[model samples]
Target chain A: MAMSSALQNGLIQLQLFEEYSWVFNLLFYVIFVVFIFYGQRIQMYVMLREVEGSLFKLKYIKDEGRKIAIETIKEIGKPQTDPAVRVDRFLEYFTIGPQSLDPAGVVWKLEHILDIRDVRFKDEVKLMAPATDDTQAHNLENTLEAAMALNFIYKIIRHFYLLGKKTLSLYIIMQIQMILPLIMREAEAYASALKAFAYGQPIGDGAGALVAAKLMRGHEIRKVPKDCVVATVPIEGRTTFVMKAEGPGGNVGKIGDAIKTVIDENEGKIATIIMIDAAMKLEGEEVGEVAEGVGAAIGGPGVDQFKIEESILKHHIPINAVIVREDIGDAVSPMRKEIFESADKAIERIKQLMLERTKEGDKVIIAGVGNSIGIGQ
Target chain B: MSKTQSNATTRISSFVLLIIFLTLALSLTALILATTFFGQGNEIIAGYLLLIGFIGVALSTYVLFQTRRRMLRLRIEIPPIVTTIECRKCGFKSVREFQRGDYIFKEGEPCQKCNEKMLITAIYREVKDKEKTA
Candidate 1:
């Protein structure tokens, strides 16, 4: 009986010892196993959480962009239905570029696709905002397009993020994290563009259009092909035929077609095609600084530039480009004072080029290449 | 729920969590200091206190970072636009707030100096400090 009592006491002492030390031991073992077996997983989860936070911010920016679009449309368009639904649908619209496997007629095919997309987008805008005039309709289209861009960015980022989370792929998460800042910068740019487009303000992209407008102002304007306007203005005793995308509306007119038409009409007698455009400035470069170069100087899907190059090569004509430098942010956002002032500088450069390169009474084609949003001819 | 409302709720909850974590970190730090300086040779207690204190501080920092980021995201503001008009004949210039229909090269009211027609020569926003990229 005494031995039995002693055994019971020993068992009680063992129980008490375990009760005191079990928590620390369990913690130590759990931590050791987690660090050893699931360290990468824990790291991935932490990064995922971080990415999720950024994703949330992106969503907010996108939603704010959409809200601005809907409100602007409702205020200006006075649409019969709630534009929110139509705007949401329009935001999801996509365009598929033509295949280039054969590479023979891809440019024309791409241009045809772009034409159809443009018409469809305009028709969608008109259907949604039937009460708007032509100018208002164009502005609304631009605003919605910016909103659509934001939505696309958000969706794409969210796609990679969710895909990463689902597969627990550190590489995917790292890729997204590395490029997140650039993506966000672009998204913010589009967000700012919404305000400019909605209000029909001139953007830095319109610097080229502004230069043309200033030169072509008070001249007898004529319609060229594809929503473009041309006027004959005398610059330094030379007869200058200046052309630009018709404006006070948001349009990057069919510049390639217009240039082709103008060249065809003149029968290859054009001396020099002076193109002015807003060029993306390098870092540390001053905004609105005008630099002269030789090329097409147009920024898009290479369609218009191709056409210009083809026509120039056929006629063996000299093409000079005067670019007004602007940051990516400035290109789409409302114009800054520096950019607005650059128009005169661009004009002076063009006049100088004309004097040095062409003879008196030579026919010079000065094409201002940009989206003439709020600049009139 | 709407995205805005959801964002508001998330922001509020994050703020509350930040406060809680900060309070916890402060209390843990204080306890650690007290235990270190005045615990009178209780080494085990001090060791545990130090570990707990660091963990608490780390959590608080994480929460603080998140809350600050959300606040920054919420602070976006739209820029205001301005118009600069100048007369071609007299070179007189005037500045005004931008209207809806304003465009570059569009003729505005007559000039104040010479009664010549003033033209909308510029429409732009004043440069902000944040936009200056050195």
Candidate 2:
């Protein structure tokens, strides 16, 4: 009897459902239409929302960078007036790269522009922080530069976000969303860089410089052009001239000029030119892994690489490179243990390269090519 | 900066989370109703209700996962930096939190072992392995 009664109730519910079937069908159709017409729009909204979240985070990072810059300047520079305005202005400062329409002599043009920019920046930094010494000033300048990078990143992302919102263009929104992760990663790196610069700590980029310092320690040091320094050390009976940016300050000294000078001073008789630097590692590669290759391993606007290549070619010198592998984040942030330890390994590679590539009493030039922040000669 | 914009975003996200949870609860209720209808032998009603409940659950779960990924992307944590000091005379080494003026190869306080000045030999971040998530 209980089963029969349940069957009866089921029949009644079934009938009621039939009665409301049109309502269900109508609701389904409406939903299907809405999805078909607005599916892309909905997806775009979701992406926009995600981008908005990242944008907020970027803004916070940018603001924190600015704050740190101002504080460091105030603490070290001891400026008389408030530096907030000046800091903001400096953050907005920009450099227009040299025109490439006439590609000939572009490198020199770029070098000229870079020199002027550097001079102007130093002047501005000195004016803002009169109390700071040369090293302190350079460190402060690096810190401010990081802040400026963060500021620029935030503004660019904001511009794209606003543009996408204004046009409601899915393509526009999609493009920014696709690369947002990479952009955010770079911005965060710059954010961390501010601290490294402010504290004058050795960063991963200093790997090469550290190796040079290790080699040149206790040797007679001489200053070269473009804020570079060189020391003569004997390795395996070869007179090795180790060169690096003058440091314990944040500077990737004009490496190209330094190399050129060293070669000219030696009367173009330098047997081998070996460059050491930090390189971005590929996926699955270990940090601090040392690799040797043949080329100028310096990374920048290609100016230093060009100069080094030119000088080496003119002298019929073979250029070899020993690179310590690191990631983008590692390059900017404070030095990691693995990367720091790799300096010794890089030095080992340099010594081995010299022994294999050159003979006894041969004059060799070993250039440690990277920013020399928080590293000494 | 007031950070008014970020505060607004936080509020909006919270509201969104609440709405998603409410929708999830409603979806669970619909699933319960569909099961009840199936037990009563109301196949037609059970079929429609089951479809609706399943769609709701799937959509909500997807949205929840996406929200989580966005949150994870925004999380930033800075690691601590340490300075390693080593005495040249006795090879005694010690590490401490990094000080502002500390740089590689800088001279530090006299060593406890040999009374000779310790050199700031290395400064680097204390990297920690990230925890594996299931």
Candidate 3:
């Protein structure tokens, strides 16, 4: 009786399958697709959670930002007791991509970028660090690298997201979706970077400080009331104050504080204030192209721009800007050969602009604005 | 900037080649499946295969259209690199396509007007925006 009933049930089931096979296939496809999508998504979040946890474990901070800078450097690549090697290693990692056609050209480019005048990078970094300690410099370099990693990851996400939204095409969306794994990898890098910054590691974005430090080499670096260091450098026979965030280990320092302090010390007797910085270029613009115009050439939070504007207006100083242009990728990622080369070109442009705008012996303030990480002052 | 032109061309041509290959393969696969289904005398399955072939054709056409539109937009998006040549002596200036081995301060061809060794005073990417008129 049981066998007969089982046979009858199998017959009925077969008849039903023939009737609803298409429905069954459709249902199976839907479930499979859903499983793939949700399963992959869950894995993505878990991966991110793991990275965040790892980054969080490597926390350290120094007076203001010393320890953070040291640990950040240690986590980024290798933490070494030798500060000089540590610093060198950290910078080498920033050039992580393809090699330049000419390494000499890259050095020439680095020189130009700093407008170093007579100062060597080694001396400058030594002066900029809290006390020329190699450990601090190493830490500083690490912090900057972390910041750059963050910038690269964020830019990638933003660039594709914007491209997809603007095009509003299914193909574009699908393409972005395909590269989500790649984006997630960049996100992991950013997590480590953010952890570094939170620990008070200085950012690589403090490029302005390095340039300023370069110009200030061979001069006495005096800490003003602000978080910045200032030095008097004569240019075209004019008294010019070059200021950068006193850095070796990492810091975008308090640029507004620096700007305000220097302007206050000058007593409204400034001829021209020229700001040189890295600017975001348009899609067609070439990396390292130099552009000159009026106003502040700073890139960051609005606070610095506001402070500079307020101080300049109060002092009745005519301010001008010279910028080295970079695309989104170049601006945030490790310094590329092209951008490094632009620094050389930017120096020439700045000299030309300063000469055209100010008379000899005119008191001027030239602020190289950016994170001064891995940069000596 | 000199690399922009070559990069765009390389990218577009490669993309075009890929689309052509895909379309050809898709068409061939669809034709083979449709013929086999028909040869098997399963008219219902043959009709379904034929329908799928038509859908493939429609998709290929849509993809081609989208690709062409993308190519045109990308062309407009990249600003042309304009090389500015200036004579150091006479200061006569002219613009041309950025040539290889050109740096901002490096000297290039002699000036047409002054016959002086002209400097590559500036190599900038300039956007020539055009307004669409109905």
Candidate 4:
């Protein structure tokens, strides 16, 4: 009976950890870390699968906004694009609106493409609130991205710390350790940006778009693209077409195509093309600071810039620009009070500049060139 | 920017969490009473009771931290200021907190740098932690 009891005691005692001397523990940790990396990759892959999953739960946009969001997410999830391209595509969608099938910010196109009924689309848009603004709209998207990235990185770290018994192979651990600081910095940036988004403040970059939306005052406006709209107003007797991305939806509709369509309909009679957008300021420049300049003063992949420039050149028209200065962070998050307030100032500036440059009866094109995500025309 | 509204799951879990906390507290108390038998010759039972108490402490601590963190996150406030004043002729501007009377196109002070008219052209707030915005 005593021998049997001793045998049971031996069975209960776990010496395997000490016997293997932690090598096995280290291997397990490495494997866990590797598993975490793969898990993140797999999760990301599954999120884009017809976009019917938990990732949608993380999305903050809903209803009509969801309509735009689903299209944007699907585009970003295109498996064929490279990682860099995917990021670029995401930025483009958030800032510029959907491309390819619908280059112009046309409402009917979205309705047809998404197979959304016209009456249903209208009702969904009616549910949109102007207060949602461009910065606030994109901030939600950034928050989701930051959260996903942070969770992935955190899981890797936790797996290693837990499974590896807090120690591992020197070389690989050293490599991970070295890269961790840099990764940490990137993570820090994401964290701050997420906080900025949470508060619904405008990033420094979104000032131009906000000002453009201010120019629209946009009740009863017409749709041009995803989250983009346009309105025609006669300024000083000149037929002016004001275009901007639809507000409260984080859509930067295709401003270039919108301009092209107006120019074509006007039969190249656009005398002066005035573009207003937010510009990144040099150090010492103030946020919400407005400036007037020559040329387009529009920033993007040059697709829209080229289209606007070509159309202007074809019409032999003079192009003027007004720019709002802001930092990169403020450009894409929520619309700040200053940026929102700057809209009034930007509107006044645009009016003065257009009056100064164009004669009465001139067909002038005033385009608010920026991501119109939260900024409605 | 958009408002961050809490999901339904968070609200439901909050009630569930309170129940869990109370139950765990009672369980830890019972475990401690069992541990008093350590000197009564039931040492193995006392040891197991002590282990359960330790686990309860760890779980309770985690739950407490999680609750506090989530509560703090929900108390997001609105940012005080949103506009920036800038110069049209030259690069001069100032940022200030929002006032009730503030609106677009309202003229403010003259430019500090070039003496041009400094108009309130852009309204935006610099985002920082604890600074809420609309």
Report the Cα lDDT for residue B18, model 4.
80
**Scoring model 2 with DockQ, what do you get?**
0.53
Return the clash pairs for model 1, or none. none
Q: Where in model 2 is the C-alpha error above 4 Å?
A: B1-75, B131-134
TM-score pick, better of 1 and 3: 1
What is candidate 2's CAPRI-style docking category based on DockQ?
medium
lDDT of 2 by residue, A188-288 (tens): 88977888899898999989999999999989999999899999999889999999999999999988999999899988999999999999997678889
Best by DockQ: 2
Off by over 4 Å in 3: A1-207, B1-134
Q: Which segments of candidate 1 are over 4 A away from where they belong? A: A1-39, B1-10, B14-62, B88-91, B110-117
Could you tell me how far off, in angstroms, the CA of residue B105 lies in candidate 2 after the best superposition?
0.6
What local lDDT does model 4 show for residue A137?
35
Tens digits of per-residue lDDT for model 3 on A1-377? 99997678667756765887899699999989987878655554454443332222211111112333444445433533534444433333332222458664453354344333212434534433535344354444445455444444444545555564566444554555566655554443343343333333222243344356556766877886445778999877888888776554444555666777877877878888888787877766765677888987776535467678888888788988877776443443334445555656766776777788889988888888875543455
Best by TM-score: 2
lDDT of 2: 0.88
lDDT of 4 by residue, A1-377 (tens): 99997666555444533565588689999889987878654543343331221122222222212333333333333333233333333322322334556566554344344333323333322232223333443534544444445445554554543333334333434444446545544443444445443333344455666655555563457876445577887767877887776554334456777888888888998888888888876667766788888897777545567667878888887888888876554564445556666767888888888778878888887787665432333
Better of 2 and 3 by TM-score: 2
Better of 1 and 2 by DockQ: 2
Reference-based TM-score, model 1: 0.86
TM-score of chain A of 2: 0.96
Rank order by lDDT, top first?
2, 1, 3, 4
